[model samples]
Target chain A: MSNLVFLPILIPLLAGAVTLALWRSSRWQKRVSVISTLVYLIASVMLAQTVSEQGHIVLQVGGWQAPFGISLVADFLATIMIVVTAVVAFCAVLYSLVSTPGTHIKFGYFPLLHLLLAGVSGAFLTGDLFNLFVWFEVMLLASFGLLTLGGERAQMEGAIKYVTINLFSSALFLSAIGLLYGSVGTLNMADLAVKLQDVEQQGLVNAIALMFMVSFSIKAGAFPFFFWLPASYHTPIIAVSAVFAGLLTKVGVYALYRMFSLVFTGDIEFTHEILLWVGVLTMLSGVLGAASQFEIRRILSFHIISQIGYMILALAIFTPAAIAGGVFYLFHHIIVKTNLFLIAGLTQMLQGTYELKQMGSLYRQRPWLAALFLIPAMSLAGLPPLSGFFAKFLVIEAGITSQQWIATGVALFVGLLTLYSMIKIWAEAFWKAQPEASGKDISLPLLGVIPVALMAAMTLIIGLYAEPFIQLSQATGEQLLTPATYIQAVLGGQP
Target chain B: MSALMAVAIGILFAASLYMMLRRSIVKLVMGLILLSNAANLVIFTSAGLTSGAPPLLDKVTKEAPVGVADPLAQALILTAIVIAFGVLAFSVVLIHRAHEVVQTDDLDQMKDTDQ
Candidate 1:
């Protein structure tokens, strides 16, 4: 049973290898990629079920003892993340079948996508800090390949900024790990959680914690370190960007939540207070940036940053309900954001541009696409009876309950701003009359709409029936807030 | 010895950040390489440098080691180095490609993507 923890990572890795072997046959590659992702999704669901039933699954590689060998622990939070990752990966691959150009498919796009899935799963499941770094690299390298695969002029430009900033962040992450190992003498997160509490030099531990904070802040696209995201995200193909928008920054948020909740609880007032301001600033800056953008993808890109602010805010609040809100927000945001990007791709497929000025009358031409878009667009704005509404309700409710008036106020204000921008996209792209200079119309590909429709339905389902999802998130929150079970699971009841 | 190595690492980091802030993408890649190397050195030094002794077990006793260098840090550095090398190599090629297409090494000229 413990061995099942490896399946999520192993399946995608094997799939990547198999897809690479079948590279010459694009048709076979697509079939294999889709089938593999389906299998991976099922495995993830099984893992999530097992975790919810049997508690955390801890696997020490090669049968080594916990502290010495690398460990992979799948608690509720991790399994949930893995499950969502597989869902997004499956949708992205399915969408990519008709959407990704032949040139891209021929150039190992499917394999790279699978590799990314492997990296994301590994990042979610790994129980060691250094091991997390390794997974991050795997993810980064694969993303770099995916980002610049076409070597288009814009892609090259965007990839340059993305690559440089991410590499710098990785350097920061590596040095922090070094300092952490130097201080704690263990890279395993559970052991670090145990030993970090015992270290005499609390100041050094705090400093290292700050270092990790800065590193992950950069990765998470928090304010002052998020310029790279908007600059690069719009340059990739929609499928690639959808997967990225769905999974990548969320991974950073997950790390912050995991580390702060489990390991860095010594100086909550200092560290989390800083996170509070960062989250607020991230929200304001990102929404304001989106408000100023006329391009659809750029606006969406900036909104990603703003949405991240909400998740970080939830983490900063540091209560059970707050963390649950963050988890719920993460779950809701990934689905809605990915669906929006895919819908943007569909609009592009119809209108041949991501520029709002050039796109118009989408509703008149394709009412179904507009309707599909509304599900996610409204949910993203926290409209009632939608998934985002509950997500935001929990987050803001937690904030108010925790006496974080200012942060809560900003979250509410950001929700309004989010709606404003979503409406902006709606007005320009769907509601307005078609411009004279817009390109020729291409019919919506059925293949493209399937994933978007399915994901939108998922958002609707999670919205209308929010009980089970909210309960799961709350349970994850409780588990994260109390790391004793996680530690014991990994360390085999050893103190 | 630790103080000297720390100073060296600090210098590497400073130089890298300086180079990274420049407009030339080539310098940016160079700076990244320097930065990753500095990070590797930090990990190597932080593990408490031990000279000459390798971490190994006795053939019979299987637990004879004492005062040996930390093998974990070395393994970590090796992994970091390889990953960094892969990323840097890709960036170098990306820079070369960007140069060919954009026709400028200056990152300022690459702002068309921002629009």
Candidate 2:
């Protein structure tokens, strides 16, 4: 009831305003942004600890009661998501502090990044469905600005597709909300979870659930809706791409996870089967696309879609262990993906380009960078004892547990192909001789390596000490399967 | 009234999809607007088209609040309208910028982003 729940959103929102006010000086902007992100990280970690120790926290804005008032709820899933978001965001700010292009530094990058974080936090914490829409808008607008910050031709071109597809997704999402409201007459998610059970029109409920599935699938960069991802994600600055790669699609996954688990369990067999097929196709298409790409960022972009498939696959299985795998995969993927993108940027910085064909000699010249890159890359490829291995292990175990042979098969196959893709990068960019004309001998500052090293260490730490993360995800999966803890925490005991 | 509105909404949705399917980016933007408007109207019609009395507290408190229109749908529509407007404004500017930079409003010509 007190204000702790709102702190995650407020810290970044206020920091955004402060950064905008100090826009004339990049020095102050950097200091304020980093400090605010640190504060956000602390607040979010404290929130996670609080949620684990004392159960979910719910705060209603304007002191109005739930089912009427807009509320923020930080259950285990939401709090853990907030914590990962803070970590990724802090890394992004740190990365930007070192490598932001001159043109972008004075041009509202810090402010927009702060605003985007605020929106992401808000989306993760909100209890109302409509409030989620509002947060999506917040994220969309800030991302729009960040995407096109430099106003270069390629940036503009990619921004159009990114903004257009996201806007379309929002429209679809709004339409779904409208229809859901017309059917259920409640915008609060917990309230809908309760009311939907009493609604006799199960077929209509299933239809709307499908609408939600498709909408969130697009945001999550799943199959048939992933074109905008590979198109635009490669165009942004590395810092921007790192944040977008890490957070944006996951927000969509979070939404899908919340709705399907909580509000739309009436027709699971039908809707989840749809998700199941989509997940397999998404995985196949993404890895295949990655296999053919020579551009480094584009390949990673496709892999993002591929990894999304694993997450969706976990959700499709829908068992406690399967969902736990999905949650674990999400946690591991965010860290690994964001770090990979950062290392890609660093590679681009060192070689003066992102084309893998034109890049080489990192192994000979800068073994440490290669070493940093190998940890996350191997983890992403599901190497044993790495974070990706355990993430994949849980999901595949869950897939087998559920007897979904084809999906389970595809999940395993994708892990192999992911290693193949990572090895392709290793061979081209690190193992081969430096190309005659392509080597530029560019240098990146030590600060740029700070975030990358930190992420690499975290990946190692998680991989070696996988028990804690697995247990956390298992608890999260339990809360999701029940949904009463969440519903009760948000709606309280007034009934 | 609800039937007519539903018909109009269907028409709008179909037309917008037709526009969106075209290759021109400008049409795509227009299609997005039409699609969103159609969605708003869908919400409007599905909530019922009764011309009802104001939902004052006294009226709402009564057990039989006669002819009181559903205010929630209207509120949702308004919020959607505002959000859609902001999105559309951004889209329009992006289209113009893309046109200026890419020198074409045709989606096919804008393949510089994809590797």
Candidate 3:
């Protein structure tokens, strides 16, 4: 059981190292990377199952007890995140294998992908704040590598801006950690929760919390700090872009959920208010940007910013149902967003361009492909009977219950704009006429289609049978709202 | 010793911030190195400045007094240094690529790539 807890993090890192050493041999690197990620995916699934059965799995590294050495806790929320990350990462690996095998970035791509997954998974599972910062850097460095792999004119230009901004963010994160350690005297998150409960006048705590929020908000691409995301995200290859678009911002969102729910619960009034306003502003800006977009992938990237607002709004509400809805929303958005990007990538392949202005009559040439694109697009637009609807429904329901008029209205308006933008893509790319088809026809291989199909099916599955996930999310929400569970786990049942 | 180390920390931070504001990428890299070193020094200073008081205990006592250096903080700083090294390596490669692909060392030339 303890071994299962660490396997998800360890396998990917070890495999990543091996991939690097074997980089000159593509066959060995590919084999090692795929096998390692598959092992990680299986471990995450098993860990999720164990959490469902046993409630939570906690392991203290190197036999050091919790609250002393770093500990990894596989709570329902973390396990679910790991499972989702593994699924999306696996799809990315598969997609890259078939689509860009001979591209210049192919040699070192798999290793970095594995390391990124390892970092993300480790960040989710760790119960220590400083460890979280380390994992954040680990993931950020790998992502920088992945982003700049091709060394193209556009990629290098974008990577510089991306790295500079993120390095600044990492500095801020370290400073925040320094402040947190100075004030709290312990870097363990669960211990900090306990300590914070006793600290009078939470001014310092609030200050640190705000610092953490700024660092994460920049990564999550919230309203004021989102300029870096849209500028750099669209410059990379689609496989890298798809995984990043799906996984990276969610890491920031994940940290926000962890910290606010656990260590900084005192100033609900100020924190929740700020989150609500930021969310609404983020929604408005993202939708407006999407409305004015020419490229298909860029439109989707902007939509990601808009959709994040809904999830943050859920946290702002600060209710069990609301947190559950946010969790469910994150789960749905990851799969759907990744699927949409891959489909867009395929469209780029067929038409030799990513601009919607140049892409049309896709449906006429490839009817099934158009239909495949519609499922996630409609899902993104909050069409019923898809997972997106349920996620949006719960968010709206939570807003209504909280009676936050602005958030609820913005959510609805954003949903409509989302539908409008998705429809614009559908009409322009699929229904309208194409000036040139590039070729008479081109058939996509199974590897290309399978990943999209798998992600779309997972989205549909979650929507149709949301009972188990809803139950798990409810449990996670309860644990988050009542963080005594985490504190107890880390402090060894200490009150 | 602690006071002297604290002054050194301040100097490192000031120098790093000055370099961070410079327009050149090489200076930016130098700035990051200095800033990371200063941060590690902060952790060291906070742990205490006694060079003689090793954190490891002799046979006399399993738990050291408050005067002893904190091994925990030292371990953390070491890990942070390694992480900083990784970041530095990545930055070196990325800057090289930027110069190669964009044909410019100045970030001002890179602004046109923005949406």
Candidate 4:
């Protein structure tokens, strides 16, 4: 393997160190951070291209082989995730560059954000399950710093709940790893895939699988584990919230797809049913929560959980088309969710608050911002010709194809309620008029508008040119369903 | 020894659950600690009991492949212990900040402002 294999992980980490070590000069910190992220974006794109052409790229660190030392594998799925992560992180940084100025909070948020992205990218690319846990800790720990950056009382309260729940989840995840290792004697995901195939103890495998699901589901904020989300997410600054809303829960979903398809495929009957029901319940609860919320970010947070249900539902179907739809939904949701959160932040910026009741008739003042937000909002509700629509269409079509009538029915109902929730936001924030003296008038810079506009355009573009995405998603899903490609890459072909 | 092991598991389970069920923030923190430690013990016991041997080699004979404890479980348990401690410390500071800033310990007090 080439040395460049490590650059994707190294570049941002080095940048983080430089930023933190040289914190005295804000100018140098900004320059260092921005340059590194741009480099990371380039490296990740190149890595994706390399993987697309050459298949899976594996790097064993410290010259140690797999199953003993950590390995980073850039398979098609991981590469695609990395590329999407780069796009989101790039846009987030661009938005924050404009939004961060003149704020009382220190600029240390940038470095932490970079480290968080590095960790997320690492998690997606790493082939080792233990490495995934470590990367998750890296991201969440950095997030802990970023979430409490402003030192606001509400943010502190929310951060405590956020960190506590995540900590508990991490503990459960570690325990699961211990049990899985004791059972299978290997922690490498690919090696586990092979070893678990021969394991006869169905009950023990199911127990460990459930433990893993509980851990990831908490991160994903599925039903019965979503209490931490609405409590914490709304308290962060708009820029922070937008980026997190777009990325964090998706990490959980990614883990679910990774482990279910890879490590625990033999016992599908037990896991699939639980996931399907969880998906349905999560969707219903999220939409209901969104419908009842008056605060802008809170409603968006609820919708985040609701949208995750769609992805899980697609996975539950376990068909090629359904899994493909799930992949499509994951891609579409990331872009749409991030852009929506950005719009919420932009709204908060313009009106100086996030309460829909306090700030009304926004379209009259900022029609363009309203348009930017409106597109993604409508798309999120699965409006026709938008990315969200295509995503939902594929999932629903898969449901119909698989004869999952109940799931299909639930998805349709959720879509309708989502539409209702979107309209509620539109009506409360844009349709109703507020007096001039009620809210402060604030103007965001043009640079801030560029990232949101770019993402919004990408969302529309995905909806329009969905064939390539769907094809890519299909190929990725095929590779996932058939584990030979992965197994061969991890375990040498001596046997 | 078997009875002691059973009692240990039982006590760990009860204390951890009690801590976890408490509504107070401090108790919640303690609950997580107890729960994680209990989990570590479960991992320890499930791997089998090795009372005779330490992992280190004998110093006097300098023997090769001497009787050593089960290394893998100990390594796994050690990692778990470290992670739990880190999380506990982070939670402690986080809770303190929440208390200082919000001037409240009751999580219910931190409900939605609009409500």
My TM-score estimates for the predictions, one after another, are: 0.98, 0.97, 0.95, 0.94
Backbone clash total for model 1 is 0
Best by lDDT: 1
Q: Which is the better candidate, 2 or 4, if ranked by TM-score?
A: 2
Q: How many angstroms is the interface RMSD of candidate 1?
A: 0.7
Interface RMSDs of all predictions?
0.7, 1.3, 1.7, 2.4
Error of 3 at B36 (Å): 2.7
* Candidate 2 to truth, TM: 0.97
Q: Rank the candidates by DockQ, best first.
A: 1, 2, 3, 4
lDDT of 4 by residue, A306-343 (tens): 99999999888888888888988898888889888888
Poorly placed runs, candidate 3 (over 4 Å): B1-22, B41-53, B56-59
lDDT of each residue in B1-115, candidate 3, tens digit only: 7788889988998998898788787888888888888888877676555777776666777767657766777787888889889998988888887887777788777775456
Q: Write down the lDDT that model 2 would get.
A: 0.90
Model 2 stretches with alpha carbons more than 4 Å out? A437-441, B59-64
Cα-based lDDT at residue A55, candidate 2: 75
Ranking by lDDT: 1, 2, 3, 4
Query: Better model by TM-score, 2 or 3?
Result: 2
Poorest lDDT segment (10 consecutive residues) of candidate 4 chain A: A98-107
- Candidate order by TM-score, highest to lowest? 1, 2, 3, 4
Candidate 2's residue-wise lDDT over A1-495, tens digit each?
Answer: 358889999999999999999989999999999999999999998888788887789898988889998989888888988999999999999999888986798889999999999999999999999899999999999999999987788888788778777877877787788888888888899999999999999999998898888889999999999999998998879999999999999999999999999999988899899889999999999999999999989989999999999999899889999999999999899999999999999988888889998888889988999999999999999998999999999999998878999999998999899999999999999999877655355677888999999999999999999999999999999989998877888888954
